[model samples]
Target: MTSSTSSSSAPEPIWAVLGASGFIGSSLQAVLARAGITVRFVKAPRLSARSTDPAGILAEAAELHDIRQDLAGDLAGADVVINAAGLATPAGADSPELRGANALLPVVVADAADAAGARRFLHLSSAAVQGHRPVLDESTDVEPFSAYSRSKALGEAALGARKAGACPVTCLRATSVQGAARQTTASLVRIASTPLASVAGRGDSPSAVSSVDALCAFVLAAGRYPGEVPAVILQPWEGATVASVLLAAGGRKPLRLPGWLCRAGLKAGYALSGLLGERLHGTLRRVEMMWFGQRQEPGWAEATANVPEPRVEQVLRAARQQR
Candidate 1:
């Protein structure tokens, strides 16, 4: 569906969403539009199809240059600003761009928002920040493991460093987010379509996932009800294993591969695919490692139960339609 604004009695607040072209950002755009709020998307470099989808809208509004650049004009009368950009490169990977995007950019965004006189600034974060903490919450000590986790933690720190009450910042650490056409979930679907779908091992990890619609709902609610809801964790109802999600997406039962065996298989698959000039190996292997490496926590499950359920059938039906 195309993005639109809902009609409200009083003039809706002008909202600026950074990274509006990303998976969660795009969804937030649609949610805000439906709330009757007129959105002024601020992206890195404006694109032609800014309002195409949630992500497209954000991409179209990006500043293009460093975020530290003046946004006083851009954010002139914005009532709220939401930063929902992140990166998830594998460990030991060389990713200067990823670091800048995930770690550094948030600081710049915060600075800009402060200068713009925005009353509320919401920072979208990852649940990975909880790291191996058995039980995570706002009070739990943060212990990030992977580069992605570290980046998110750093972003949160930056948000915190900002003088308190200076545009009350709310940090939301979200679990694995799922939706109809997100790259992450699409990759999971692609891996499920392979012959080696049965390679997943020991799928007892209690991981949480959030649907795209639910994520958007949270973002809009945050924008609409800032301070009223300071910060919270968000996850899907009934945490599922990688294997279960694959099965739900129509893949056969995954083969359980031991750690050593899975590593060997990945190496072999990469070598063979390189020789055959085909992309056979699954990219989700990295994700699987992240999921398995970290200790499971129940924070997301506890928090998400309070939030409303998303239209899962609608999302699934949309995926089917695309197929």
Candidate 2:
């Protein structure tokens, strides 16, 4: 943990973040460190894929118990527990890893946070909860289609199922978070930067993409929030549209395509994905997001605007630097 305190009587709030080595978690940790906050990182086990085998279940259970016990001790002086661990690779959705990190691990982390009497537990969830929503909100219910989304939804449900306890819980439904360490963002920028343009749904749909900087702002604001935060908060859109992304990437305007053509393409893609199962599910969702986009109404970010986010161009430039 980085000690950012003086001999002053009032000490700064300490943070204990799981998956601190992860792309998003590490970025947030850096921001927290720069802010002179004490942030301790607890490592979670990367267990093998789960199966129907009873032995696998029992083994996983034992591991979870051990992690919970160990983490409680590590969280001694931590005021907030941020769960940024999870299997994010859409390709690995069908694997058992998703269930462990995304589904089972959150509940266990929450347990440890509660056991340690942490002031807050911020769960890093995904907007993938509702795959193709016109507008995503805190009140949005889980209607996941792919394994990755399902696992995330399951985690949220499990946490909700638990009895209300000491720790105040908040779930951050991150929308298309991108960072320099993310290969996904690199690929996306390459595609978007191509001297081609794509305009769909009247060319007003939000890009549905956000940066690590913005996410960091949200995390800090939520972490240091004075009052009780909402149980669920969607990432506030920063007004980046598909056209804007393309303009930033390639410095050109795109041709407008009919919304019906986009919808038709989506229908066919979904039908093929359904026949194949799971593999293309997340990809199709991303495609839909690119075409139709998703809207996030002003909420928590607006309520707690303590932290400042970098400009969209700065964020995209960082993504461009990604290998």
User: Candidate 1: worst 10 consecutive residues by lDDT?
Assistant: 45-54
RMSD of each: 7.9, 3.3
Q: Say which candidate scores most in TM-score.
A: 2
Candidate 1 lDDT by residue in tens digits, 129-196: 76656555664358865555665675566556545546666777766666887766665566556765
TM agreement with the true structure for every prediction? 0.70, 0.89
lDDT tens string, model 2, 68-178? 788788777789999998888764446677777787777777878888989999999998887666778787476777888877776777667666779988888888877
Report model 2's TM-score to 2 decimal places. 0.89
Q: What pairs collide in candidate 2?
A: none
lDDT for predicted candidate 1 compared with the true structure: 0.58
Clashes of each: 21, 0
